[model samples]
Target: MAVSLKRTPLYQEHLSLGARMVPFAGWEMPLQYTGIIEEHHAVRREAGLFDISHMARIFVTGPAAFDLLQRTVTRDLSRVEIGQSAYALACNEEGGILDDLYVYHSGPEEYVVIGNAANRDRDFGWLAAQKRAGEPVEVIDRSDELGMVAFQGPKAPALLQSIVETDILSIPRHGCGYVDILGYRCFIGRTGYTGEDGFEVLVPVEGAVALWRRILNLDVRPCGLGARDTLRLEAALMLYGNDIDLTTNPYEAGLGWVVNLDKGPFIGRDVLAAIKARGASRRLVCFEMFERGDIARPGYPIYHDGREVGRVTSGGPSPTLGKNIGMGYVPVDLAVVGTRLDIKIRDRFGPAQVVRRPFYRSPSLGG
Candidate 1:
């Protein structure tokens, strides 16, 4: 039997907009509305709205909620204050990344953990299992009742400010606050995956359609997963299953900044500390194709001096850069900028050079 896919509250809205639907992470989501390249450029030049309710929103509350997060995730959540959010990774005991998520400190004893759709159940189970026999933490899966929408771009704030009563610009990067949108209570976070100034709004499921339609009235481009993937790749952001997974560690995936070895103790502290001391053998690097005919893709073999060194994790053509760019794991010695490598695409090898991560950066956001 074919497993039935789930749908967000905005499913009908997507259909009404003539979206091309496809199965992604057990959900029937819009792959594109207008077109991939057109939607991608819209977000880069103006503002684009995305239905991201497919992402999991798990709430952790109680007196021990902070303690629960401090032990499970790699980042030190104790330092996060109310209205602040941080990107973190949940790792297993062996220091392998399970999933990368965002934790928002909603209040003194409340936190909202936003995780990938594919890892929702696994992420919740991991946190629930880590609770001691009498721990006070309560892990609740509120994803079904909540709806998430990401409005991203350089003009995102201006667009959002016109809709909400609160001043959108007052919220700093990685900060979050509650505001009223069209008479509905919504939580807006100044965070996004596209490396642009934006907000991820969480509203009740019943209010999703209304909010989406209101944003649409502002002439915001409605983006889909196809454009989201390309935008994040251009920003060099890691996809959970693609760039980082059980076989990859944070240090090796170029996510060392999120790992706090000095913080008391966490699940992967010991192994991560050891890796930090010895250094990673292989490092993730971003590369741009020197030749234009072929585009690099995931699972393609990477070679240095005719020796198979690693494999591509994420690869595709960047809409903003108008060139083929990719990220792959390569030997530490060959991961430096300006290093030349060959990517085996099908029958032929293509010339590529390692460049800085975040292949594209918005001038408005600054370096």
Candidate 2:
């Protein structure tokens, strides 16, 4: 018998928008609303909204919360004060990535860990098991009780600021705080998967629809997984399963910046430290198709010279860049910018060149 799929609070809201539904990570999610390319451009030019309730929402609380998380993820928690969030990686003993986590220091002795949707059970179980016999910590899974939404794009701040009385723009990058969204108290973090200035809000399931509808009425286009993928790909942001997984390490995946070796010991610290002391053999690189209309897909073979050197992890047409771009793991020697390579598209090799990591950057990124 087939198992039943889960639905988010916005499931009916998505249907009302005539979204194309598809199965994703055991959840019935919207793949597209109008069109992938159209939605992608809408986010780049103005604003777009997404129901990200499928992602896992977990809370680690108690006096030992900080200590527990400190010994688990790669990012140092010393700098992450209350109202700030940080991107981190949890790894197994062998240094393989367990999951990429977004940790928010919500309050004193309290933290909210956002894990990948598919790894919710495993992540929670593993984290709870990591607590020592006397550790004062409680791991609570709130995925079913809460829903997530992402309002992304250049106009995201101004549009969101118009709704709530609080000044949303005051929150710096990676900062988070609770705000009243249409009178619903919700926690929002100034971070996003797409390389755009946006916020990810966590709200109670009961209030999700009201907030979603209110945002839609503000003229923000409802986006789907298709546009989300293309947007992140254009930014070269690594997707947990596609770009980084159990077989890939942080350094090899161009995520060395998130790893802090000078901090206290953590899970997989020794192995990761040793790897850093030496060097990673392979690195993830972004490449663009040399020919027009040649979109690369995941699992496609990458060739240097006449031999297959790597496999594409995440790839597709970058609507913002108006080109086909992809990311794959290749030897360090061949991952340099401007390196020419070929991607095996079905039966033929398509010419490609390793360009910079992000194929597109929002004009509002730095300034």
Candidate 3:
């Protein structure tokens, strides 16, 4: 039987705005509100709001929270103090990533784990297994109780300051605070996926629509998944379902920097260490077409020396760069800057070259 997809509290508002809705990860989501480029620019130049309530939120609160998390995720949870967040991956025994997530230390013995919407069931099951094996943390799936809102762009801080009572301007990047909004305590984190300064707010689902209206009333345009996709692509941030999956390890996916083998024992530690020792064969790199015509896309063949070498994993037209940019796996020899190659787009191939990660850089983040 086909299960009915869920909708966020802002679904009616999206309809009122004539947003193009589509199914994404089993949710009736907004594909675009205004035009993709317009929404993209809104988030890049000013503030834009996103309804990311569909994303999974799990809480771990217990005396052994730190140690239990330490034994599970790739990053060391011990180093993350309260009010800070760290991005890490949950991997299986063989070093294959189950899902990539952010760990937010909410208190001394409390932490919230955020995961992709599609991986909620699988991730929860894995965490349950770990608990059964004597891992001392209590994992509670609180996905239904929370509503997540992302206010992003250059004007994000100012807009956020006007809504919530807290002084967000004083909060540094990656810093989080608790604020009262609509008579409820909200966990607000100054972090986002777009290559811009922003805040992600976790609030009670009951006040979600009111909060959404509050943001929209503040002149922050509503952005959809279409604009979100293009923005993240321009930033060269990896998407879980598109860029990497269960088979791809951090070493091969150009995310090796996030892996800390010296942080101590964790699942997939030995496998990652071995892969690091031997070095990776294929490396992920960003590239652009030399000419203007072809649109590079994922699964497109990459050619070097007239031979099939690699394949594109994520590609799209970047609104910020005003050009087609893509990321893919290529032989280590050809993954350097200025390495010329070709991208097979349908019946023809176009001139392309390998560049560096982050096709576009953010001056604020020192990218």
Candidate ordering by lDDT (highest first): 1, 2, 3
Better of 1 and 3 by lDDT: 1
Go through the candidates in order and give the clash count of each: 0, 0, 0
TM-score quality measure for candidate 1:
0.98
Model 2 worst lDDT run, 10 consecutive residues: 358-367
Quote the lDDT for 358 in model 2.
77
TM-score against truth, every candidate: 0.98, 0.98, 0.97
The segments of candidate 1 whose C-alpha lies over 4 angstroms from its true place after superposition are none
Clashing pairs in 3: none
Q: Report, for every candidate in turn, its global Cα lDDT versus the true structure.
A: 0.93, 0.92, 0.86
Whole-model lDDT for model 1 versus the true structure? 0.93
Residue 40 local lDDT, model 3: 92
The model with the greater TM-score, 2 or 3, is 2
Candidate 2 per-residue lDDT, tens place, 65-163, comes to 999999999999988999999999999998999999999998888999999899999899878988999999999999999989999989998899988
Alpha-carbon deviation at 54 in model 2, angstroms: 0.5
